[model samples]
Target: MIDYTSPIQTTFELQRRSLEQSQQALEQSVDIGQQISESLLAGLDSQEQFQRRLVELNRDTVASALDAIESLPGADVAVDDLRENIDDGYERLLDGHEEAFDNISAELEDGTDSYDDLTAELLETVEEQLDLLVEAHEELEAQSVEAVDELAGQVEELQDQAEDVQAQIEQVSEDAARAVEA
Candidate 1:
């Protein structure tokens, strides 16, 4: 009739809530980390665009300046060489940006997967341990109930024995009265 395992049940409920909160926090943190990564990549992308535009502007300015001095010997070859070098620099910058993005993205993905896996395992372990505690508590309660039943049976048997002795005493008293009358 009494819920002896109420405390354990309450503890389990509280632990479950705490675990759920932990899981939620982990998820939120992962999302925030991902957002940060995306922001960083976007910033880098914007910078790359800006740098490419700057290189283009420089190339055009140099070309226009050379055109103004086209009467000079080798002016055209000098303009072409300057443009090629600027183009090469831009290409290298682009490659570096791509490499950095790939590295960061890969690392973030791997880290996320590891964190998720660790969280799942931790939660599962806690649940399993909690279940075992409940199971053990239930067994203990069952044993207590059995012991109480056994004790009650013993007390009832003692009472029955006492009543039998009382009946014998009365019979003996009557026999003595009859003997005294004779």
Candidate 2:
């Protein structure tokens, strides 16, 4: 008996793992953002630290963003590959089921006495394979949806952070202008 479920199961597992990794990456990004904000606020007491921290923050932020952008293509490729694997699995499952049914029908037409036993066994196998495929598909779909939602939330958060940073920079500029005028 050919085990058709293993490949699908492995694909789902790989996708789930990838999702987990992405979530971890997002968390790390958030952590870095928080650290940058904290560093900016903390150095306000000292001119040297304030200037140094700002430089460091800019460098870190740019580096982090570049790292993220670079990783995106690989992530996209993984997702595309996963989708292709899923499509292939579905096609193979359907083809196998169809072939099994055709074979059983042909045997029945020939008035084979063993057709009943063969059909029953084939039906059971098909049902099991179908169930596995459906379950895997549902799991993969749910995971993908959840990952997308989380990523959207992360993007929104990063946007908010950017806005906050911009506001801070503007305030600093205004303060410097006032001091210069005085």
Candidate 3:
């Protein structure tokens, strides 16, 4: 006969191990999900700010270029008028950049504030529920202890009653024996 059963068993075992490994990996991912969320939220505002800073650096580079142009040796053209227009344009561009950065910062601050508020509210609710759960558990434990103690006391009373009844029966039997002899 072919060893089909042995191969099937081996295949099943391999599949079982594979499933267990996958389950463990999934469990580990679930465990870290919260940490990942927290980390991303923590970085959210800062990441945007960093990007804004990098973008603003272009302002400095542009200013340096204008400064070099202003320092250029006497040109054949009307440098003052040319410089004036360039400076005006630079001023407008700088204002726009500053305004944009300010607006973005304010928005980020508002968003982060709201996010923090919501997270805090969520945490408070969870904590309250946990406290209630603990209180309920404690009450249940106390009730259980009381019930067990009451049951034990009843059992002891029943045992004492049984022994008393047994003693009475022995006494009655002795009395009967004495009566018969008399």
What are the lDDT scores of the predictions, listed in order?
0.69, 0.62, 0.65
RMSD of each: 7.6, 42.4, 15.2
| Candidate 2 lDDT by residue in tens digits, 4-43 | 4456557777866765566556556655655654454344
> By TM-score, highest first, what's the ranking?
3, 1, 2
Question: lDDT per residue, candidate 1, 1-182, as tens digits?
Answer: 33444555566567656766776676676667667766765776687678667766776776677567765787777767766776687678767866876686677667766766776676677567766865776576666667666776777788889898998888889998999999
Clashes of each: 0, 0, 0
Candidate 2 segments whose C-alpha is farther than 4 A from its true place: 1-111
TM-score comparison, 1 vs 3, better candidate: 3
Candidate 3: which pairs clash?
none
Candidate 2, residue 175: Cα displacement in angstroms equals: 1.8
TM-score of each: 0.45, 0.37, 0.49
In candidate 2, residue 143 scores what lDDT?
74
Stretches of candidate 1 above 4 Å error?
1-76, 142-182
Best by TM-score: 3
Candidate 1 accuracy as lDDT: 0.69
